[model samples]
Target: MESTAIGLWGVPLAILAGAIRVSTPFIFVSLGETITERSGRINLGLEGTLVFGAMTAYAVAVMTGSPWLGVLAAMATGAVFGTIHGWICKWPKVNDIAIGIAMMQFGLGLAFFLGKAFIKPAAPHLPSIPFGAWSSYPQIQAALNINVLFIIGAVLAVLLWWAFRNTRMGLILRVVGDSTDAARAIGINPDRIRLLATAVGGSLAAVGGAYLSLYYPGSWNEGISSGQGLMAVALVIFARWNPIGCFLAALLFGGAGALGPALQSVGVSEGYYLFYAAPYVMTLVIMIITSSPTRSLSGAPGALSITK
Candidate 1:
């Protein structure tokens, strides 16, 4: 009986560990998307930016022997991608969504092309705080060996949440998202605001990519992202465009993502591949539950196309 109880507890504990490990990317990407969406722009090309960021980060870390500098390089790369997207989207009759898709392809191609040589080269790893040092269990210690990016992401969420509600810049972003006409009437340059927002968003998303290469999987490859950037878009919707909500939603999705592996570890593996789809299924279900054709979801930006 005691063994059974312990086994049951292990599942949840493992799930929590999974959440901690997996939520970092979600946190960074979703928050970046939040910033872009709030400025009445959407960049589906974040998928590309993420891949490129990962490649750049890995390459920089390997050459410089500094993970932090690699992170900065990734941010710069992401910003450049965002600037290109912003510049092109400003053209008349340009479709941001289509451009995003194109960018995604371009990013993937570039990453694969440049990262081909980096496949075998090892890079310096990011630092992690040992919160589980007090625990005697190895599993607990492993679980607590989380990267610093997680804490930074959490802090950014809280700060963004407060800024969105209390800061002048946040109000301007909200107004722009709600109505370009309103923003113009108030002397705000909607296009400029959106461009800046997208740049910042791209930088943040790249930070998540840095985390992937410098920490988690800790390698350079074409398959580093695995749709994490795209999933983050849906996560933003489920989070109702709130930065704090994005953080919580990320943790939940991260846990669901870890479910398949956790179950397989304890000798229960009936549908291994199918278990991997848990996160997508959860996203679809949540979309259905939260969506309304007649009314906009709570916290959605009015001018954003995704909500409609």
Candidate 2:
């Protein structure tokens, strides 16, 4: 009876907490993916970039004793990776998707080889605001804790959405993404614009990895990410490529990803594992709902390869 009473209050709180914790990575990665896709390219190798980012962040933190620097290192390295991908895909007849896959494998191999020594080192974690301070229950307080990165992501989403609508740079990017001929007619370099966009996207994705290794689950390990990188591709689709939509979608995914654990916390252990499927299920449902036979995804870049 007491456990049930506790769960009545606890489950919702746990899920909320889970949503924040799990959503941070999704937001960063999906936002990154959104930026790249908006420029008419898709980066499947983000999984590799993500893993490599986590490894790089962890290793740098261990060496420098500063988590922020670790994140910066990850961002810089991710940019290099993205730059490589962008440069390679600019060539005639080169496939971006294939290059992404190769990059993913290469990154994974490199991270594993380089990250071996740092597995046991303890790195400092990012600071979090105690939004749960008013709650008397320890569990409740813990659940309400919010991190700084989440704040940055939320603000970033709104900024990107606004930029896409109002900025000249955003206009140029859209033009390039929608039509290379249009870009050429306007004397804009399509390849150069894509290269810059890809670099920014790679840096954003690396920030997600830094959050994973330096914060929640807070460790340097091979199994740290549960395909958040690839899943963000679907997430980008679900968000209709809108930055704000990406943020909301990320929170939804976070809540879903946290559902199983939240249920377990409420003593609903049996069948709780099924709830772990929530994010993937949501992804499928969204995809089905969004699919169309006659047109590309409503907001998708015209030049993007994966059209409906």
Sequence-dependent TM-score of model 1: 0.95
TM-score of every prediction relative to native: 0.95, 0.96
Poorest 10 consecutive residues by lDDT, candidate 2: 1-10
Task: Give the alpha carbon lDDT tens digit for every residue of 1-308 in model 2.
Answer: 53344547788888889999999989988998888988888898898888899999988998998989999999998898889989998998988899999998998889899999999989988789998798667777888789889999999999999999999988988998898889999999999988998888988998899999999888999988878888899999989899999999899999999999988987786999999999888878887877778766888899887862
Runs of candidate 1 exceeding 4 Å displacement: 1-6, 290-292
Q: State how far residue 213 of model 1 sits from its true place (Å).
A: 1.0
Off by over 4 Å in 2: 1-7
